[model samples]
Target: MGLSLSRMMAVLTKEFTQLVRDRLTYAMIIGIPIVQLLLFGYAINTDPKHLPTAVLVQDQGQFSRSILGSLQNSEYFRIVHVARSPAEMDKLIERGAVQFAITIPGDFTRRVVRRDKPQILVEADASDPAATGSAVAALSSLPIEGLKHDLKGPLASAAPGPQPFEVVIQRRYNPENITSYNIVPGLVATILTMTLVMMTSLAMTRETERGTMETLLSTPLRPIEVMVGKLTPFVVVGIIQAALIISMARILFGVPMAGGWAALILGLFLFIVGSLALGFLVSTVARNQLQAMQMSFFYFLPSILLSGFLFPFRGMPEWAQWLGTILPVTHMLRVVRGAMLKGVGLAEAAPSLGALALFVVIVAGLAVKQYRTTLD
Candidate 1:
């Protein structure tokens, strides 16, 4: 057919009329860029500061107290817990409750007074090397800087020699400081989230758009069944994405599967289900495909921000951390990282798994309830 200017104008006019009728689409067109601006401008900060730290102070010495003060003043470490024993400190790090654990020796005061090198141990959860790298680097000069006041006069002169105290950093899990070791596992959660949520979130909206939702509702199948059926295909999709990401992580990024296959697989399964359930819940509320897409992006911003994928989970404020706890992404990140890097078993990742199970139950229950039976 020959190109016609009139025909093109007619089609353009039709599209503009349709665009005006779909107010939600217009709102998304205008609002998405503004939201992205705010999200990227205000919410995202990769150089996270004031990471949560724990203290195991075996010495009540002035020098020990000064070191703690310096850590706080550096704005890099926030002492959230004061563990009484090494065992307690281990539990904190293992659970990811604290990013760094500072342990002062009992003889630290005496050794510093005698001009001998006293060692203070700083054990870090190095699973996310970016989270710990800056903090660890800051510790190098802290001992000398902190003791400047106590090292007045004679001790000041001794400053010319080796520092009286040493800050020993024990970077656990990822001692080699591999960035991919942290990023690859997080990619499992990130990929699953983007795919599973976005996929299922459009289920009802797409059906509604195609004018098939009422037909599906007319069937004997319950709302829950329809939701589940629509979600199952996306579950498989999530698994495929996981497999590809995991394979690339191992082959290209040199990421290791430190834990058993079964444990990682189980965690992935639970997390995938939870994400699909969340998407189903979103679909229940969205009136159309555009609204659904917009809502999915709205949920996505927080998932990436508070879920510990881009920044240290503990680095955020207490309220933000608590908010993140409700997100399956946060727990999934912990599970995947622990299993892959820390070589943790299922039991070790039980807390995260349990959280994921709770999220699935709540989200699935809400979705089942939210799905309209009569399509009003």
Candidate 2:
């Protein structure tokens, strides 16, 4: 037994052959690492720049123009909208339409000329503090540098001393910049995505592996009916999990539930159903429980990374953002954060909810088609 090199080599060769024959496993062995490398190396980013900003310029004076020019030059703030009123600017920030908003009061230029220390109100969406941290840090220099060129000759006295004006940065949500406020809400999406997709896929694959699938198909139930019946239990489980996470977020972590429960509940339902539909699609493709698990892992990887649960979604490149947009977890995170932190109503949560609905329809349709194919 000690000297059996030939037999060991023979067994090793047989195992290699078996591995090659399992094409799905072979592909996963090669694909998972490549995906991980590309996502972490190229897609993920921490310091996000070019964040969308809106400006409300009440003073059409030279100083106001100079400050706007300085903001554009900062590269961190990209002026996307010129709001007409304070209400409009507030709406932009509330709806997540803009990350930062700058309001130059009507008397800004006059105050600067009188050395009265004018204030520029800068409102930031601080739901994800990391996304706005650098941009907020960059604002400290704007009061001096923004008006440096304008305060010359007659206004030279204003330039030499303390800052001519003040930039008041109001962090809208999570004013304390609490990390748990962001992470706890996001956990709802991440946890549901991880568990629902894996659980549904494994359950379905288990039926097939145990020969229960053939018995199920022998019954007169249509594919869609069968799919619905199978997914019902997982949906209940997902709801329970979501409720537990949200309760902990409120009671344990002190995460605010700012918006009405109606919006949050509707969004939660849609996201849970959508995730389960995706899992059903994976089960349809997989031949066994192992393959189902691997496929679920593949889905989970991108859902966790690109969906902005761990990293800032806007921090990633355009291509990565586009990839994340298609994921249900991305919209789920938005819906959760918007409701829990931002106090967004049903109207504001509508877009993300619509996206999740579309995902459910598309993935569930594909699952039904694949299940029919299996019947044939």
Each model's C-alpha lDDT?
Answer: 0.83, 0.91
Clashes of each: 0, 0
Q: 327-361, model 2: which lDDT tens digit per residue?
A: 99999899999998988888888889899889889
User: Candidates' TM-scores?
Assistant: 0.85, 0.97
* lDDT measured at residue 332 in model 2 versus the true structure, 0 to 100: 89
Candidate 1, TM-score vs. the true structure?
Answer: 0.85
lDDT by residue (35-128, candidate 1, tens digit) is: 6686556555556689889999999978889989999999899999999899999878987788999999999888887777888899999999
CA deviation > 4 Å runs, candidate 1: 1-21, 158-162, 260-263, 285-291, 315-323, 346-348, 373-376
- Highest TM-score, which number? 2
Q: Which candidate has the top score in lDDT?
A: 2
